[model samples]
Target: MADDRHQTPASGPAPNTPDVVELPDVTRRDLVARLMKIGAVSLAMALAGGGAVTTLTTAIAAESTKSERKYRYGMVIDTRRCVGCEACVVACKQENKTPPGVYYTVVLENGFGERPDDRPLFLTKPCFHCEHPPCVPVCPVGATFKRKQDGIVVVDYDRCIGCRYCLVACPYQARYSDFGENYPAIEHDTPWADVPSPEYKQFRQRAEGKSPIGNARKCTFCLHLQDENGRYDQAAGRWPACAKTCTGKAIHFGDLNDPDSEVSRLLRERQAIRLKEELGTEPNVYYLV
Candidate 1:
């Protein structure tokens, strides 16, 4: 039985068997580091509304769409800034030489004066250039079309049959039938009539049985001012006449494809509304209400 003390009994704990290993106490620094990691993850999700991976994916998709499409030029009108000066309307006529009763744009005034505090609001209305323009399909001659290059709706005067289908189809009432009637000066064949209109950049002098006289007319966004590639030089004064002449700077025009443009930025930042949205025309024009 010598050295029996060194050998433990089989039922008792062995010399190598140690007490249960205990975990180290969590330090304050460790707790803080864990919280910071969680917070970073949460912030990324909150910013992206998804996760970091989704954020990167969305940005790439947006870039791809922009590179493929030219632009859907549109307008963002700030009603609060409009002064009902009708400067825009006048400028449109001067630019396009539209005859009487063929208004490309108009100012509609609404009064909310049930009480003394109630005020009147002025809205500048132009062709909305709907994603699905109602005026497009009804054209019997395929004269009216929303340009594939830009979203601006255009009428091929040469093909137009002088029918007023577009005027009835437009939800915004943006189209007008030009009855070949003119102001006294033009009706009388005065020198003013000799000055060729800049519409379509055709510079065609006024004459009976002309294109605009019989065909339906609407705002071109002054497309004539655009270059061959449909790019307008704002600094060179070759932009929409209504926007360039706005007395209150209420009208903002730009390509929707460019996220950096002023109209796009305003739409992102402000509460904007489109007319007759229930119809699902998806009008490009927006009103800052």
Candidate 2:
């Protein structure tokens, strides 16, 4: 059983031998076998090294691509289009059934001075929905978080123990603690009994009216609107009610990732700014100066 790698070549004459380059047939065959074995070993080593390099390169490239992916969900509010219409404020109140004093949306009126020629500008204010939301840390319970999947700050109502710490911690004054109350006259008009929407979409029983009824709530960026089914709705040209009801079309909502999307284009083209930019909360919501 000759080793496969050392198998001898077929027998032939070994009579001729030059004086200067004298070598027996058996010696020549042995030398040839040794060279072939070394070549095979070198080839195997080269292939193994090449394979390792290729695998590592591919892995590193994939990681670099993933890490370079920017994930800052944001919005652009065009102040020029805002016409002091409280439609967004009214729509939000209607959509969320907010108590008389608790408002999820408001308009800040900036007056240049009281005079005939004085100008008053209206700024639509909603949850800034900060990237590093301050509300997340103050909660004794793990109720609030910025979702890594989409960067939308959210409050888990079930986990919220009606503590208003988040409400106070928020710089934008976003959170609102719910009070169990409903207009007696509008009892038949349950806002939750309609098409899909975040304001009234997912409902569970509040514990003896202590549920979300007493828990804090805030803008969710219309979470339901970000779902796959919602995108299907958007493709058909339907948007969230607040944006749909804006007569001036001041509010724009779309994927921040798609560079060509309306929001993305506005961010690039306008002198957009977020509220309290100095704090470095990195609010996703932006306002056009």
Candidate 3:
């Protein structure tokens, strides 16, 4: 009999025989390219997910920081307690040593109503230290800015050009332009002239041509009296001069952000109003009607 292995089948293959298969040739470059494409797609997906996570984290942190502000120094003035006296004005001047015609605080009589029979409402007006201060953005030289730590609006006298732009921009008329005027006691060659002003802790003395003489000035909430941590010790007498000197205890100053602070309690207990609320200045100062 003939060998079965050498015999040829009439059909493609025998029923019990296995068939041989041929595959297309693959190169090293092709394998590498395919792997690289898969890797790139994975990396792109990972990066997109990572970027989204990072953005979410940043937004959360910003919101948390805004809600947790350390201090918001503000005041709550009781209109009933104010007696139309100008003691606060005098105290502010003495503490800051401001020049004539430049009062950091003022007492406005009959601010609420002008009826002759109606009782006069004496309002003690100071720099409101607005959350969105218009004077800060209009400064041509960036001399005025709001402090982030305590939300106090302050002026950099050294950077001021005495342009008076900030004065015009302020809706509250809180800014003043110093035109080199002096009082009799602080006149040149006088004893008070040699005395240094403790404003911003600079302790600058009056001179013929110097800073603060021609610079725009405003109230700083008497920050110079604050300690290094921006804290005011009421018992230690390190407090705002205007608030400390109010004879009737009309002015209540403290960290408004503190839930247990005096100003916060007054706001919760009494009906308070801020000046120019329509302008959206969001002033830190509030008046209890």
Best by lDDT: 3
Local accuracy of candidate 2 as per-residue lDDT tens digits, 1-289: 0011122222421111111322344443344343344333333344444434333333333223223334445567777787888898888776655555577777777722233546667787778767567887677765666655455667666667887998999998877877776554344545443323235356443223655677788876655544443341456544555666788989887666566788889887888877787885767787776
In terms of lDDT, model 3 sits at 0.77
> Candidate 2 regions off by >4 Å?
1-72, 111-117, 186-200, 204-208, 229-232, 235-238
C-alpha root-mean-square deviation, each candidate: 24.4, 23.2, 26.7
After TM-score superposition, the amount by which residue 287's alpha carbon in candidate 2 deviates from its true location, in angstroms, is 1.0
Best TM-score among the predictions, by candidate number: 3
Winner on TM-score between 1 and 3 is 3
Of the two candidates 1 and 3, the one with more favorable lDDT, higher being better, is 3
TM-score of each: 0.75, 0.66, 0.76
* lDDT score, candidate 2: 0.60
How would you order the candidates by lDDT, starting with the best?
3, 1, 2
lDDT of each model, Cα atoms only?
0.75, 0.60, 0.77
